[model samples]
Target chain A: MKGTGCISLASCKEGQTGKVIAVLGDKHVRERLEVLGIRKGTVLMKKVQQMGQGPIIAAVGNLEIAVGFDLARNVIIRVEV
Target chain B: MRVLLTGNPNVGKSAIFSKLTGIDVTTSNYPGTTVEFFSGTMNWKGKTIEIVDVPGIYQLNPEAAAEKVAAQMIATGDVLLNVVDATNLERNLNLTLQLMKIGKPIVMALNMWDETKHKGIQIDVDKLSAILGIKVIPTSGRSGEGISCLADAVLNAKQAPETNWMDKDRWKTIGFIVDKVQNLSGRKHTTIEYIQDLFVNPVLGPVLSCGVLYAAFTGIMRLGKLIEKTVLSAFEKYYSHVILTISKFLGGSGFLHEILIGETGAGGVDFEAAMGVLTTGVYVSFGIVLPYVFLFYLVFGFLEDLGFLPRVAVIFDRLLKKAGLHGFSIIPMFLACGCNVPGILAVRNLETRRERFITAVLTGITIPCMAQTALVMRMVGENDGIFVLLVICTLLTVWCILGLFLKSTVKGITPSLLMEVPPYRLPGINAQLKKIRMRMTCFFKDAMPYVLGGIAFINVLRITGIIKLMGKLAEPLITGVFGLPQDAVLALIIGIIRKDTAVAMLAPLNLNSTQTFVAVIILILYFPCTATFTVLLRELGAVDTIKAVLLMLVTTISAGGLLNLALSTVYTPRGLLITEILIIILVIEILEPVKRAATEKKQ
Candidate 1:
């Protein structure tokens, strides 16, 4: 699978693996995400995508974290297509 | 010496702390369960050691309230006991590195060690400890493995020497350490992981949650009713005979006799209608209420430990977001169904005061506690099962409408939901039973005084002619607006004390079916029971609690008045039900778009 340039994590299809490129949102949110180990270069597998603009579940290493719609849209990830 | 137990959320810090100190604090599979810290002391090796289970946090700088609390606690601790999840070593180490910078005497426990092996994770504990310059113990907090060694390590813990790693590249240092000490073999998806996936799948997730919750609700109700019928009836039969014998001993009908055994009619001491301190009060508290409470806490404890609540939260996030709440609000709402006190207490878990205020208010207004639900089921269901359904539908509609209203009017932002989803694990039966016992003890302690005192006070008011005076004073509003008789004013008055007892009070009024339906709905929406009232005050403070109570009163009168009008005018129950459903749907349709626009603008 070749790496697609970069896309909003919100658009990542379920079961797709990606490496985080940038987190674009409020500084506090960025810091909070950083604390959860979802900062730049972290590889995440999109596990579950809720219907509509709902929260999405992604795995960082072995830890699974739920990211809300707005925040997930702000997370830029390079997907392996 | 104070030893603070610190770790990332859901890493079993509370489990370890409970094991060490023998204090049965609430431990669950989800993050943020321990919103507040608990301290307990134990005698370790002839020395007293105090262990504090600090609210879990991921980093030391601290942005949230619970994180700030953990940060403050770490500063004052004599020793730091850092618990880490063995399987999620990389992420758990993020907090460990930050804690080591505090320069306190620190020891590390590899919690959930038993799961690591099955998950194909191998950790060289000695190497990790050597590299980090801290005493590391491989311990399973849930299984009580290597706990004594952990305690011994905490006793002899030493400060981890500071390293020269760049602050900007802390993750790099963590990566280096993890690569050195941790090994992973290829593994397939486990059954638990597969179930976790199914719980978050869009289509199946909602179905499963609804199925699980509905099953739990009906299961508890069935078991509770069976116990109430069989065990309580058996006890009531024997106890009534004993009480009737004692009444005859007191000559069967004096002032003291009336106070003790209540009004003894030709049928002897009637437990439900007697209204004496011993007869009705005991039956209302134990026979009517205790079964539901016991069953509720048991099922709730199991769900909480199984890590299913967060999945429910995630599934409901989109709909709840429309109401200006994060999905996590589902947790406290679930708690409130069991009882409102712990439910209100759990509101502190929300990140913003606005979310907390809104959740607390909606919960107080709409969610009837288990005891009240049981009584409502018996009373209204016996009259017309349709009315019971109506009552539930009415409260749910009110809940959604009130939530939307609060979303538009509340002054702060509701932060988006971003939380860790802990994996599922079977709850230990022993720990589950212990938690249920602790909750039952708390319930009885908080409720007994109010239950007995409220009944005693009601008796005094009746005997002293005060109730008659009060009833006459409130007659116009009771009869005119609510369409209830003046006798129902007593139930409304006692409703302020306990809703279950208030519903029981309705039995003696000989209310017709319509009046019963109206009275039950009003009792649910009016004011929270006194026990819940105090908790609301403490949790939300005076100003918010007052606002909540005022909202409750307004909603109660309006809803009650509307129900009376609808029931009296409609020739058919089907028309009434359809009208109620249409009104609910219309309200949601009208309010939802406004909330969405407002949230989008804010974003």
Candidate 2:
């Protein structure tokens, strides 16, 4: 629950993919996101930073989403890496 | 045939157009979003295909610029080429799915195919097409990969049956379909994440954020000097030679020659009689503004490509929110470093009216663009040490005070910040050079036309004695109200006309140190340039725009009065310039540790 010791996004040494449980943004924003289909169970995967502090990029399947140090903090996950 | 192309920001939509049509469109990582649109035409498959590059939006229901324009395009477009970021498929597919539901003949072009291989991403193209029920073409516009195939797909789709994907509510529904078809790897927590968690943890994030702010601001000025040195000399050489040849042919000292191109005194190039406007007009825009502006965008593009701006948002988000704004508002502030127009237009992304109001005011007033900054630096750098420090400190102080004051006065109820922090990529030299070339071309095109017209207008006015009449009319306010001379009044008029032109105007005034400082202050606040004016008018409306103008006038006058009083009365030789810099940095630094300790204590 706290830290993925060595798991990777798909099957690497450090990342894992997961679904969005809730896009718990503020009301207007949350509503807007819901309309965009960026809602509950929308799959995402954090590509653990290979360097620096940790995962610099995240993934949702093949698509790469670069995660700044700040955003990766808000994303919560149930690991299967 | 109408073909609408849309993609996420930083994708090659505009690049594709230029390759297709031979039109050079200015592209940028939208200071606000990662997306925007460009439209051009290409002759393909025996028909003139009018391709509209719809601003790349994440969805049709967009609150941001690209998304809004994108949705509007969808409602009207006949053929949709939804350009998705191949490197970021699932997030991109979200957009692709939305486009499909727009009911147009939708095809997805996965731009940046080379990045996928470099990043080691694998895409199941056949599976994706089957799931989405639309054509998906993988492309590498950079390497000329799959472009012909893409053209063929477009040609084929235009000829094929009409698909009514128009149920937009389906964007909300398609995530489930994406889930069934897309086998994503699962998420897992790791020690590395835990390590990252330390930096991103709310308590520490703000501290790290502050450090980044200090670094970026410091870095901009410090690196700005190095970059200016590298490029300025070449610009000087090239322009001097070109103008020298032109002047020689026109006979530099001739009555016709002197007005079109001024004698090279200090900085003024005398063009003959009074039409001298035409010569200097070309010089100021193409010679001065062109090179400097192009350089700024090149640096800006590099910074953007490195993904530093969003992190900047994260850093500033706390202070900005105290003003009842969000981190995303930083996008406009950052862009304001370029121009206020796009900066103001960027405010539309803010969720509420109040946020937009505050953003507009801050952008117009506090954020000085490359033009302003260049002139300010030129003056300050040339001046005596102490006054330069005061000017710099005064600017920063005013920026902070305005943010605080507006936050207090403006009524806003929204305070949320959700932004993606793209990984810091080293801006490729090839890409950087291309971006710079494109930007310079755009800037030269945009500014050259305006300058030539303005100079020509002024020339016509000068011959008719209208500039004198205008200057005479404005003299009372210039001398009495703003404490500047009658001649400097003309500079203010030209300042509002074009910043570079105004800078050129100042070279002939022969003002002493204090007068130079006063002139700069006047130039900085007179009025938004025409480009900014149009954007502000478009974004904020006539009444609000008027109010903003009034605010600028009052603030500039009051500020000028105070500065004049201070300089004339109590000015000392050795002021607190260095002390100010140190104290500001120290204050900025100290806040971080104190906040961290407090957060830790609470935890």
Candidate 3:
């Protein structure tokens, strides 16, 4: 888990579970992600990634959030095997 | 004393607010439903208290307009009733922790408590209260469980002891507290979860959404038509005769009789065609508009509570993106299909002024209310379904073209969709009925006076011969450009008050199919009714409203002219198809340069 490279949450396949490694972007974006429980160490599961780089839907702590494609790309996570 | 109801999105803060205040602010399963604050009064210990239901936000620092409103509202309240979703205590407590730092007296309502147990989640409420240094009352906003205790907690709420935690470290503090007081036993994934998964499954999701929407649309329309024929016609038949008998007893030849019962033709009162306040006004509102509005709201309320809106938003995100709006903007447009006042008001949920303006303008111009649609169906649809289809297609074309035009011209970036897709739950019928009842009450109280008064005002103008003079003045444009009769000007003027009534007025004008189609399109495009106009003025402010109105005027006249020309020459299904294709091509050509420039600017 430590040696494997981290991928952006946007790249995670549907049904993949991951631990958020870091939320990239400015204070505002990070704060938004944090408030929704998507900070470092938070475990999230990818639910749906709409085609054509649409919003990325994921579940974090029983609540599903639809993050825009641009924002989802900044959320780095380590997918569990 | 002002008590602010604050919580993370979709935590039933609105439900709790309604329970405490007896005011019905709309409550929905999805997030961002309450985009503006609603205030109502409640009696606490024999003292009247003012309570405000603030828009839900994930944090104190604002990233959007609704969140900014919530943050501003937080500073003005004497006490904060912090609602937390009991099923998601760990995540919700982050906001609760932030509220504690505001130093306001806070009482926590553990809402959705019933769901927590169902999900195999357990919370030590006493321990949680001790840790946060506040009273924590477990309450179910749906079933009203623990509401009295919540009210007691609110009345006796005390400010927390000063904490050493910094704002930046609040999450850590929340984590620490949640570890001590919350426990989640592993539970099996249920059927609802599977259904939720299917709803967002890119391919099946969109298909299911279309199916659901089609079903809801057909159900609402069919039931509405049924009620209109059965209930509404029956009510109008008896009510008009009763009013007619009374008017006749009172010697029905004077101005008062004209205002009340209207000109009694040979057959009956002629409620629809008559321009009288009592006849057309009552008939339009109660007989025509009320049935459709009721049926639409019932179906819409059920859809809203069932939590399908966000999924619809998800499916329509890319499509709405072309309109320079996020998917959530569709909510307001959907509401507009029922009526435009609440639709215009719902634009507050959008993130930017540009988006709100675009959505409002598009909704006002293109989406006909159920009443207007019903009227068009009865009149034009009876002759040919193709004409009805043409009306819809024309409006859809206008929606797309105008939306793209506004997007390219309006100066703001359309925010991307960042929303919670709540789990689909079966709607509670009792709550749904209550919501419909509340909305109906609001319609009667807020919209009815304007409908009736506007009719009376128009009637007065007609009696004084001013309407005729105005009609003469509007003759060249109304008859010459739109190809409708001069009397249609009166309908156009009355349209500003009520669009359905305006269309109904077309009945007496002896209009052919083309004239009726053109007139209906113009009525839909010209302007929203006076009630909607007032609400839009308040929502978008004066300058934007003026811009929107000007846009509507330009679009309405041009659309009427174009339709008349098309129908008069080369009038065929292929001709309409060609016109639609030309519009799409024109929009694309216009959009390409804008898209290129935007990308260049980004680079």
Candidate 4:
């Protein structure tokens, strides 16, 4: 997990599953993401991504969350082949 | 005794509240529908029990306004009804454990129990109750199962022992309980899951959303018109004829006669055209407005409960960003299309003050409620449909321009969208009907008096000749700038009270097509009625309300003046469309650089 390439969630294509390696943001945003079950080591899959800079829909443990593109780009995830 | 209903977002808290109290508030298939708490009273065991539906939240510490309200409400409640989504027990128990820290008497309602079975999620309710030291009742708020047991359990509720546990300990406790009491078996994918997947499909999402919205709009309009044409007109005709015959028999030219049934028109008594308190007021409210409002709410309630609104938000997310608002902001706009009061109130769901102010102002100015829109169609649609198109296009342009201006100037950040999209479910018919009934009842109880009183007040002004005097007083600007006759001033005055009535009054003024178009545009832009105005003042505060009013005046006058100029020379629908395209391109081009600069500064 440490040596594998880490990519931002925004770079992940639809239907790609990944493990959240780190959530890079301010304390408030990280806490918000934590409460919604997106913490380090949590597995999630990209369900849908709007074209261009639109929001991305991701699934974390049976919950669908729509994340802003800016925030999505900050969530560092390691794609699980 | 006050019993508070609390849960994580979209866990059927509102549904349980509705079931317990027999009072229906809006329950949509999305989080954040209950932005503010709702209260209802019920007589349980011959005691008056007050039930408060607190907005759903994930944790005790709050971020949004709704969560803050819920957190505050927890302290004031005598007992807590911790409703948990049975299908997602592992995730939902996180909130249940948090609520237990408050040390209140908690009666756990395992809601959506039926759905849990469908998804092969089995819960050992008795074991959960014993482990948590509380009574756990398996309830289906949709099907009214175990409701009586829940009611009985509330009376004997006991507080769970408080534990000095940190956040980490709380999660450990939830994990322990979930592992002990819950079991899940693999199940095949259902049709609802398939449809949900299709709705969010990148290419198909936009197309399906447009198709759904178009179908809903046309359904409401067509059904509303059909009801209005057949049943409403027949009832109005018969009632007016009967009233007129009695007035004629009583010698129809006296003061009492005038008060009862104002001056007659070509059709006997012409209730709407004549300004009478008894005849016209009753006719306008019951005959004209009720049909449209009823039909619109019926369709809206169905779609809302069926979990279609969030998908709408998702599809429109990118577009709404251009308006300096979130995709969920469309909920208020859609509600505003029916009426502005609830629409303004719905602004509470937005996270930022800047969004609330911008949305409130744009909605107040440009979005005409159904009553006004109906009248606009009746008056203008008969002459030419293109005029209707022109008026709509003008409003859209003004909306975009104002949104961009506010985005550039407004000081706060527009929070990115992070909304929960609830699973799609077939709405219960009874729930849909109850919602429509509750909303319609609110309309009649709250709004009907204003409609009646407004009409009577206008009649008094007419009887005293003050309306005419004021019309003459404003003649210079009325005739010179907007190209309407002097008497059109009275319609403007009445428009402030009720736009539909004001539009009805315009038929007597005999303005030409372009003048009528300008007049309607001005009417929509000038100000909302007294009902919406009061709500705006309460929501946006005095300073912002004043700013909104000033903005309304400037927007109306400028839009009216410009439209008058355009239509007076070289006006074609094709030309209007081309201009609209150019304006959009120009606005986007101008905003791109500013947006980049703002993001650069933020970084």
The numbered model that scores best in lDDT is 1
lDDT ranking from best candidate downward: 1, 3, 4, 2
lDDT of 2 by residue, B1-603 (tens): 788777665566775665666666644443234234566778877878888766656655666554676677777777888877676665666666655545678777878777665555566777777766777788865556787787778877732233445554454445555555444444554554454344443456556656655565556555665655554455455655666677789876755555566556545334211235545665455445655566567667776666666655655655564455766788787777775655777787776777887788767765666756766666656767666667667555555555556666766566445444544445557667776776666566666666666666565565677878888898777776666777776667766666656756776677776777767866776577777778788887898789778877876777667666666667542444454465455434454467679999999
What docking class should model 4 receive?
medium
- How far out, in Å, is residue B492 in model 4? 1.7
lDDT of 3: 0.84
Interface RMSD of 3: 1.2
Worst 10 residues of 1 chain B by lDDT: B586-595
Q: Each candidate's fnat, in order?
A: 0.81, 0.10, 0.68, 0.51
Which tens-of-lDDT digit does each residue in B425-537 have in candidate 1?
89999889889988999989998777778888787778888999999998877898899998898888889998899999999889888999899999999999998999899
Can you rank all candidates by TM-score, best first?
1, 4, 3, 2
Clash count (model 4, backbone only):
0
Chain B vs. true chain B: TM-score per candidate: 0.95, 0.77, 0.93, 0.93
Candidate 3, B1-603: lDDT as tens digits: 888999998999988988888877788887888887899998977878889999998887776678898998899999999999998887888888888888999999999998898788899999999888899999998888998898888888898768898877777888898889989899899998888778778899889888987787777778777876775567566876787787788697777776766687877767777777777788778877888888889888988998888888887777677788877888888889899988888888777788889999998889888888888777877667778778877887888888878888999877567788888888877788789989999888976887788788877888789989998999899888999888888889989988888887788887888888888999989999988899889988999999999999999988899888888887775588678867766664556567779999999
The structural similarity of chain B in model 1 to the true chain B, as TM-score, is 0.95
lDDT of 1 by residue, A1-81 (tens): 454568888987888899998999888889888888899989999988888778999998877899898889889999876
lDDT (CA) per prediction: 0.87, 0.61, 0.84, 0.82
Best by TM-score: 1
- How far does residue B75 in candidate 4 sit from its true spot (Å)? 0.9
Q: How well does model 2 score by local distance difference test?
A: 0.61
Positional deviation of residue B557's Cα in model 3 after best superposition, in angstroms: 1.8
Task: Give the CA lDDT, 0 to 100, for residue B126 in model 2.
Answer: 79
Candidate number that wins on DockQ, 1 or 3? 1
Ranking by DockQ: 1, 3, 4, 2
Cα deviation at B15, candidate 4, in Å, is: 2.0
Worst 10 residues of 4 chain B by lDDT: B584-593
